[model samples]
Target: MSRRHVPAVLALVAGALVAVPAQAAHAATVQVPCSVPDLVKAINTANGTPRADTIRLARGCTYKLRAPDPVNPGNGLPVITSEITIDGRGATIERDGQGGEVPRFRIIYVDKTGVLKLIRTTIRGGYATDCPAFPDAVGASCGGGISNNGKMRITHSKFTGNTSASPVFAQGGGIDSPGSAKSTISDTEVSGNHVVYTGQEPESGAAGGGISNDGPLTITDSKLSGNTATVTPDTRSTAFGAGIISFFGTTIKNTVISGNRAFAEKGTARAAVSNGIPADSGRLTVIGGAVRDNVSDAPGGVAQGGGIANNALMTVKGVKISGNRAVAKDGIARGGGVRVGPSGTLDLKESRITGNTVEAPGGTAQGAGIDNPDGGVLRAERNEILRNTATAENGTAQGGGLYHAAGLPASGTSTLKRNTITDNRAADGGGIFRASGGLTLNGDVVRENRPNNCAPTGTVPGCTG
Candidate 1:
């Protein structure tokens, strides 16, 4: 789950599953008991089992997992090779690797593409020192969680209070999905998982506080709360997605992303601190959920969809984005809710985007809600865009509610239809700023969303405003 070879294995398995001709075989269920209260032995037995197998863990048992082998040569910890399914029966697999070595290991690692399923289990990624200098890297950071590289399906599972470092870094403190792994996580609760990237100079590397998805991934109908992705600037890296970081093509639907934070000041003196879905390539879609009460020094800067520096295409439908703040004392910033690059596109449909803010108290430029640079595009339909503010008075200019700078083409090309745009304030377009590029509107309620434009601050001809 930590390295990239697991995904390769999954690809091989999926290919084998699809290509290999086989007669219909009855499903084989293997019982791997942690009856001795030894979670590590149970895991080792399950992992050592052959492929096309199912491991059913006993119910009502409490497993104290042992420390992983310290001499794992490649990457962090050993890899789970078999195409196996591990099922926990109302059991708790806790990380019991007490204070010994500086490094630690993950709880469940699904390596191949075969179905790896879990039911009614609590996986606790115990606690460990996740500093950059630690021997183990992000994937193998201590804890009782799972690193999934293939098809990982979880139902009725709980993840609690997994800590990477004292402060937390970009470790998969709770659940880590590396790449090209398809996951179905239903009825799962992930809480209090912190990637404490506390090092002498924390800014050197970035960490995934709760969940880090680097490839094509999908998470549906889950709860992620109270997770922290904190990094020290001295480490010279980015700390983001205190709750979740989705790179590559990722889709999260019918889930809640709340109370997560990326605190960069505690570690070192890094320039930017990011949280919640740091920028990367691919398609990210968030539908039917809320992204609220999450914070970062620069939360989702220069990107769209959700949170920091995203370069992928972000599409949000039937979602609520409220009380999310993007803060940076530096002079330059954009897209408080989303800082989209010049080429990225942000499309929101039937979504309520309210109470989000972009503030640059120290430097100059900033945009409150959506900052579409010269080539960027922001399209909203059948939604309420309200009460968002951008507060940069001294030479801080552009669309306060939404800035369509000369860099990002005209809003004339962007579509704002059947939307209630009101009560938003800023230096430029207080309600919405169509600075240079024009925005198009159709059947939109241009209520009180006001901007400080030069001409009539009313609806401009091009912005259907």
Candidate 2:
């Protein structure tokens, strides 16, 4: 029992403590035959625990929520507050109908403090209707299938037949993330989702039938198709972005946004993929993507940007924008391919804007290929603007190839360099229309357009028949 012996013993104990590893965070794995209640219990347990958990569903099984609490915030499952991962193994999670109507609730809701990851799953038949009791205060009735207010990552997943309906505003029929939530989706398919608004005014309409992101969202290798946003008996309301509406910045790569519809029965409908609303500060960057076969129809009102509506900043490289239509039954129709609104900016390179049409049966049609209206700036290089049409059966149709509207309080400018503009049809300015803004045409071949190549308005150098 010497002092040196005591020091040696203490050293040995410290070395033994270091050799023993600290207890690792326990991860629970929940297996198949997962009923609604069982899934809810697993999620709750994971949220209450201190570590991440995994929930594995049986292959091809469909876990349906038969009866859900209509007024609760999260109906089928409790709000997720911790890190959890759900591996579906090609299974499906759906909300069943009570009587004849789908349950008015979302399938999964992630709270602000939660983190959820979904892989290889199918989410279908979720309906979020009359949600957030105080819709005006919340500003969202969204995410019929999955709503994330936190961080979410989805890979190899499919979202189908999800609907977000509200009397006021409905957004993100498939997935909704607002405010500082971050989400990354890869190799996913968002299809057959609908965002419908029955409100009387256009300001209280629906948007983002497939996905609504007010936060930062990145989507890669994804397909958004057969989605719709509709405003019924529209009264100046805008039903836009059938594929996606990013109120904040969004990055999309290797994506296909096709066969989407944004239709307003009476009011203004705009864009298949909208970067941001006029009041929001956002940007859209698409690299190697295709936006085609989309329609924006405001039968009794105005229709704009059948393919894309950029109210903020947009940069598109190596993208194909084709076969889009903007049709108005009574009002104006503009930008069948792309629309750059006031204070908006667009930088397009190596893109194809072709076969787009803007039809205004009773009003004016402008910019069938590209529209830079009122203080918007567009710089397109090495792009093909061809086979576009702006037809006004009763009114004027201008700028079949490209339209640069008169700058009102501010001046809009467009620079088309190294572009081939041809075979377009319009009442005036068949090739290019420059009203008040400056349209700079450098190394652009404007030819073979019906009626004339360029309108004699603004100074467009290098424009000839």
Candidate 3:
């Protein structure tokens, strides 16, 4: 009962405290049921904590949102404001009203302060009708399945059957991330999404039927297919980027973007994969990807760039662009495979552009394979442009393989080396069409075109018959 006893007791107490361990900041895992309310509750609980939390959904179960919030209509769940991960375990979180009367709302909304990671999830059946009402400020309507204003990572996920139906303006039918938001999508599938606007006169239209990113976005091992961006009834509105629209540039690797359609009933329809549509400051890089079988059709207006439309600095390497169609009713149709717009530069290497077609009923069709028009610069190396068709039923068809039209002086230049341009079909300049551009073709083969090979009807420099 002396000082020795006190020391022994203190040691015992310290040992007991160390053995019990202080409350560690362990990540909490909340298992959720198949109810949307329960999932919301779990997310709210996770938001209260500081550490990263995971909400795991019941395997194979579907959590459907029946109605929008009465106070904040068109919002399905509580806004995510903290770092949280939703592990769907191959389950689905969808909007309930498929055929019944249901309010339009996105499935998930990530606020500016949120960091969301979705894994093995399926987000579907969302309809975003109005956007200014929401906090993301992407447009009038955007992000049908998920609207993200913060950082997000989606892995092994699927976004399907979502629609952005803003009558005036819309973007990102499946997922929309605007402003400074950053997102990475890997091993994902974004399919069957649509962006549609059916308003009249000066009402503008939609873009990115699968995904729209105004911020930095990177996608790897992903597939974007069967998406549509349409503007109907109103001929003044336009449509673009049925698979994806990246305004702030996007990096894609080992991806496939196919079977997408951008159609305008009266206005302009452009691009299955639209890069840098909003501005020219962005850059697009595609490595080992395939963009094929897409359609850009303006049955009553103009259509351009059926496969890829680049309006910024674009670099494409080891890519395949084939079987895309750009069809117009009475206006010009151009660039069935790839189009570089004004002030844009396209650096293509080891790529193939084959079997693309541009058709116009009464207007001109140009550059069925690659179109670099109006101050666009193209640098090609070791590429193949083969068997493309530019058909104008009652008008002129030019440059079935490559169309290089430098609109302004010293604005457009095409530098081609070690490229194959062959067997293209057009009324004139079946292989290469050069109109007022600085064309330098070094070690290139231009031959066997249906008509002549080069424009001006002669053996151009660095090209053969």
Q: Would you estimate the TM-scores of all the predictions?
A: 0.76, 0.90, 0.91
- State, as a TM-score between 0 and 1, how close model 2 is to the true structure: 0.90
RMSD of 3: 13.5
Report lDDT per candidate. 0.57, 0.80, 0.81
How many steric clashes between backbone atoms does each model show? Answer: 65, 2, 1
Tell me model 1's lDDT, rounded to 2 decimals: 0.57
**Clash list (residue pairs), candidate 3:** 131-140
Ranking by lDDT: 3, 2, 1
Candidate 3 Cα outliers beyond 4 Å, as residue runs: 1-25, 70-72, 132-139, 179-181, 277-281, 408-410
Q: State in Å the error of residue 263, model 2.
A: 1.0
Highest lDDT: which candidate? 3
Between candidates 2 and 3, the TM-score winner: 3
Ranking by TM-score, best first?
Answer: 3, 2, 1
Best-fitting candidate, scored by TM-score: 3
Query: How many clashes does the backbone of model 1 have?
Result: 65
Residue range 309-387, candidate 1, lDDT tens digits: 3434678788777776666555344565655555556677887767877665654445565666656667778887778
Q: Which stretches of candidate 1 lie over 4 Å from their true place?
A: 1-24, 28-51, 70-79, 97-103, 113-115, 126-144, 163-171, 179-181, 196-207, 234-236, 265-282, 298-309, 330-333, 393-398, 408-413, 450-465
Expressed as tens digits, the lDDT of each residue in 437-463 for candidate 2 is: 777888888899987898864457777
Name the lDDT of candidate 3: 0.81
- Residue 59 lDDT in model 3? 97
